[model samples]
Target: MTEGPDITFVLGTRPEIIKLAPVIRECEDRSLTRSIIHTGQHYDESLDLVFFDQLALPEPTHHLEVGSSTHGRQTGEMIIRIEEILRRERPDTLLVQGDTNSVLAGAIAASKLDIDLGHVEAGLRSDDRTMPEETNRVLTDHASDYLFAPTEQSRARLRSERIPDERIYVTGNTIVDAVEQNRTLAAQRSAVLAEYDLVPGRYCLLTAHRAETIDDEQRFGDLLTGVGRVASHLEREVVYPIHPRAAKSLEAFDLDVPDGIRIVEPQNYLDFLSLEDAASLVLTDSGGVQEEACILGVPSVTLRESTERPETIDVGANRLVGTDPAAIVEGADEMIDRDGEWTNPFGNGTAATQILDTITGAERREVSPK
Candidate 1:
């Protein structure tokens, strides 16, 4: 099958949808044909459908309802369904973002079918194989023809792993573009601050749903307790827009929601970005949020032992604090009072254009490996 000029994106979770929206819009702006396939990995209406509506993106060309399931089942089904779409559409390139199972599946399906595959935000390594996301990203990099590393550090990691240099490009993270393009819209359109009756720079934001953090009751409890301690120490509220998975875990574990911490339902993309932009500090286990906090000049305390986005830490915008109450408290205290002096490492908000240009160039280069 000959490669076409068109492109297809495989995205499922909220981060994927948000990060890829800029590129999708770029495709539309250039009048280039593109297809979006939703793997349904994020089936919750809160996590999935509202993002497309909020971001003003086109409806997915295909939705493979591969909802919540064990890792094997979900990834396997996605591979099968994505393979079907690849066969039917036969697009030139299949692009996937982040470290989700959907990316891994798309990479596998496209690689097996001889379709040129691109992994956006590739070459990230937490170096912890226990984390499924680490595995997903690593495998996706090896299988991809174009590895869009978000930073030079990421490009170095790909070199260390022996990924051919020709395959790697240090195109700054698309999160920068998403944040730059949307913050004004969020500020103008979202009333999340008033809806919560919170004052800017007087409240903290919290989000923790990674399996390593929430799957164990002890760790999750400690994280909540620590966040609560910080909230009390600062006399500020810690607002958690609970992810559906974290909510279920709380119920299953019978964990108590500590004082000084208010739990809210999940928020849409714009609302959450609004909260992050105005917060005194952010505590999260999400890579996207870490990057967002950096871009928005908000200090973030990452609730994980390791992170793939070390650029956040290097810039003095974030701290990698494991879920220990005392440590979390200390990390929050250190970050809350800091001046927003760090440079935004992601880019000048044109990653989508650079990525699309690179892909277009790759087509010519792929014709002759020169």
Candidate 2:
């Protein structure tokens, strides 16, 4: 408990927060010197506490306050600030999760700084180079010292890319750990279902925040219209916890979010998880929600053209419905009334412990001669 690797976690955005939470808790439980640097990439700074506080995790040791901007500017600013933090903190390893600009910046900074880097949820590929996330994942995988892949499929992808097998550990994803642990916590403390007047299995939950879906006015309108039809067709309400960018897009595009869909402000992680657990269906463009929906035994429709988490679709837990009104409605109709009997392909929920044990038990890597 007194001694282990000193680690720094660099994360930005809600998905990173939710997924990395379990690993962070493990670090605390070990009394390891773990430092967190939150990039403040997509969150409102004031609401940052909602994630950390609700998760019962420590607030970040540092916040870079790099809010939304164009992709290039956002990522550039993050790298600059992240490098400053890593140089000063100089933790033995820097940990990053998933494929956000924050992850890319953190990976680049850590690798260049000569600090060992561990990437959780490594080797996932949507295989669409147009997506910034695809580029982030590929680059970060190459940069990482530890590639914690969630499934054999993911591990195979890394092998195909020639990433060293030794660097890869087929540790199950930490989201399994986070969701399994937090849903119980949500049951005890969260009143979200009651507060929203939602009866479990009678309503749909939606979260749409991706730029490719929402930033395009026509696509955004199509998504809303499709969800509206689903809600009206089934006489069930669709609850949307809108992201700031998507909300602004609605006003800027002068798009009408049709009836049968209730627009709500962004929810803290616990409240959102409670909603996910209770929903009859989930429609989302976010990658993390796709996994959460599968893990919670809720059927889902992914709003994007492709998914890195195809295991959800393969397991019969989800359908990949691109941004078309009819497709969305049809996917909803097919999934909404089904018995959700699909097996979870992610993990059995001990990923955080496995990842920490791997890092702790393995000796620090010596640098190759330049």
**How many clashes does each candidate structure show, in the order listed?**
0, 0
lDDT of 2 by residue, 1-370 (tens): 4787889999987788889999999898888999999998876743455688778889899988898898899999999999998888788889999999999999999989878899999989998899999999999999998999999999999999988788888888899999989888888888988898889999999999888888899899999999999999889999999888889999999999889999998888888889999999999998899999999999999998999998999999999999899999999998887677888899999899888988887533443322
Clashes of 1: 0
Model 2: residue 206 alpha-carbon error in angstroms: 1.0
lDDT of each: 0.91, 0.89
Q: Write the per-residue lDDT of candidate 1 for residues 58-137, one digit (tens) a residue.
A: 99999888999999999999999999989988988899999999999999999888688989999899999999999999
List TM-score per model, in order.
0.97, 0.96
User: What root-mean-square deviation over C-alphas does model 2 reach?
Assistant: 1.8
Q: For each candidate, C-alpha RMSD in Å? A: 2.2, 1.8
lDDT leader:
1
Q: Candidate 2: where are CA atoms >4 Å away?
A: 362-370
User: Model 2: clashing residue pairs?
Assistant: none
